[model samples]
Target: MSPLFPALRTADEKEALRFGEHALSYAELAGAAGALAGRLAGAGRVAVWATPTLETAVGVVAALLAGVPAVPLNPKTGERELAHILADSAPSAVLAAPGDLLPPALAALTRIDVVATAGAADLSAAEPDAAEPDDTESPALIVYTSGTTGPPKGAVLPRRAISGTLDALAEVWAWTPDDVLVHALPLFHVHGLILGVLGPLRRGGSVRHLGRFSVEGVARELTAGATMLFGVPTMYHRIAEALDTDRELAKALAGARLLVSGSAALPVHDHRRIAAATGRTVIERYGMTETLMNTSVRVDGEPRPGTVGVPLPDVELRLADESDGIGEIQVRGPNLFSGYLNRPDATAAAFTEDGWFRTGDMASLDADGYVRIVGRKATDLIKSGGYKIGAGEIENALLDHPGVREAAVTGEPDADLGERIVAWVVPADPQSPPTPEELAGHVAAQLSPHKRPRTVRFLEALPRNDMGKIMKRALGNGNG
Candidate 1:
């Protein structure tokens, strides 16, 4: 629970981060974070532009260490979204990459200090008390959701939440000092910040960060050497698509000791393809904004295709209704968030009477302890003519079809059926796009007639937010 960055630095001086053409040692990075934290303490709520870079990483830790409540924002945020977050966080100070990238509103803001990506000066000698958090229960970060379903809400994560997640991940993934984590996910996301930045630092390991990810770019990083590679399903699928045939991505994933996937469902097809391409089973896990991560594919045994493996240490998962094998996934663990910031009403509604965080996700668990996610609490299944249907089931079946590249299924309002399945998809070959009739025929062979999509809409590409999550709500309600 102590400063994780300092812990990593103490463990290995040579621990360095890869940024562009330079390599940054742990000692230097820690010093910069400490000094910058000292400079940015005036902002009661500080918003730091988040991206996967050595500078962004240090800036976040610096703000927190400075006792400024930190809010991580997307770099590409437009005027409206940027204003909302900036106003909500109300940062009196700003620490940003130099140039016009800093908000114009920032000029009027008092006590603002902008630190260039050109690492801050060393502060080992002048290190402020920096108000090292005395208790793990204190808030360590504030991250805003993309608000695809509704307005974005800020989730406040305490030290316990992050530390507990790192501890749980270290055990589940068997991360150690010997490992080098390769980070490619965006920093604004919890998956990138928690798993990419904090998770590695807690285990006293180093990180190799890329500003962006391309099939070829990641391919090169996979070759650069690392003990573990963590990414969302989209990244893994891209890597799988570009790798060798026989050994698949085995040679590409040559240096990695393990691969972990979360942030979104890791489709069965993509999971198998990654294993076939790289000879490494891409371990798909279950987690969300409220909880950093709870379940993951184990290091040793079967990394099943769809299941998110078992719960991590100190975390317990159970169905709200135990009799049914599948129900709301309720969890009790240190890794869970403190609550939504400034929303006591929401906080009260987030947990059950008994205190488990009600993960909106619906899931089913096997006797051997493997768990497969079914749907979201707000929107995972559809009801039609009093018959319930799992959207993932239909989407997965559609994805298996050779012509389908990506698929998302949602239940749409129907006058007769109450709600019916509607599928939006992207074909593998745009020129040879499959007809709705063809897709319906393809899924009917696999899915129950009741579960077959009532409507299929072909999209050049499914509408997804910056994080690559397929926006089913947008597709179904005619919002996009």
Candidate 2:
């Protein structure tokens, strides 16, 4: 089997990674990561304090080189959640940048300084572990899911899954060694660490990370010849908002080869705004923690605003239990995680006997096979007035209204309707906010009358996780 990152071996002394002003060429990265990998070899498992820094990237790459499963710990995680993860993964030691203040929870474990290990090897002679994993089934990253349903479960991703997903995406997006990707996403999740960082390395391409997301930073990077941009909906939403005033930002975005959004559905409103200003359509893709990537809007395909395009190569996707063209998305592919860590029962429950992994997301397939995700079956699927409604569509409609700045839709038990649609909105003008009647009328006019919000509650902002995904469970929990 080929190495996951061929660039680490064969690429020239060109810069491979940059976070803010700091950078490492291909040779420097190899030296740093190789030195750390040699030290990390035979370590059972290691936890990386996954901060948005060059050290975090080096730590993860080193762990992979050592044939060790690296668990990425979100730095923003609370003490209780952090304790649960440390206990669950049971890493022998932690890898973090020098001088980073780790919480008391991590103090019990031995700490390996990542930056201190750099330049410890001969730069020209440094090479990563040549031996590939035992046929790619070997564990690479143990990523924990956002604990929306319950406690976060670690999804054990294998070498094959990482390489498979990146290869499939490369085919669809026309990703190449010439492409320079830029993003400001956190390094903890799949969108950031796996795709935003590792994707470029696999293609032997360069990546520039904005340590913090800013319109100026995006403009600066893209203007300096970055070909691709990856961001979640919230980040793209900021870009859309800034494009009206920042001509340089719009010009930079227009010059990019590809702009992609994921982690959540980007509103149709923001999509139109960006396309109008920059003439560049931001494509959306669908995937989960268990499934690295299932579908994507192809570079050559029609740039649909709302749909997440078609399934990628080698991924067999099906919408199980179809009713009104909406069903649970189940998939089977090489790009799937082996299972949740140490929870055989939970893992068994996640898949069918025939081998399809049950993705709890509810979506509908168009005639052209484009997947339009509505919402989660647990929270976003509202069965009301003898009709099953998707909260995503209603939320999008509410967003179309001039008065609604940010919107989240949920279903509440009602006496008349089986479950009534409730819109938690951050209005554009809070002092003279759109009333429940006006917002309901706006949605009713856009969509069907039944899809309108039965109750409209105004908020200053929506409750969101580190990834910018709205926490539907936390809605009406006194946080909003």
Q: Which candidate ranks first by lDDT, i.e. highest?
A: 2
Q: How accurate is candidate 1 locally (lDDT)?
A: 0.74
What lDDT does each candidate get?
0.74, 0.91
Per-residue C-alpha lDDT of model 1 across residues 57-164, encoded as one tens digit per residue? 777777767666678878777778777777766677655654435666556555334343334555453254767666888778888877766567788888888888
Quote the lDDT for 217 in model 1: 55
- What C-alpha root-mean-square deviation, in Å, does candidate 2 show against the real structure? 1.7
Clashing residue pairs in candidate 1 are 248-277, 249-277, 249-278, 250-278, 360-377
Best by TM-score: 2
Every model's TM-score: 0.92, 0.97
Which parts of model 2 have CA positions greater than 4 angstroms off? 116-121, 124-127, 130-132, 477-480
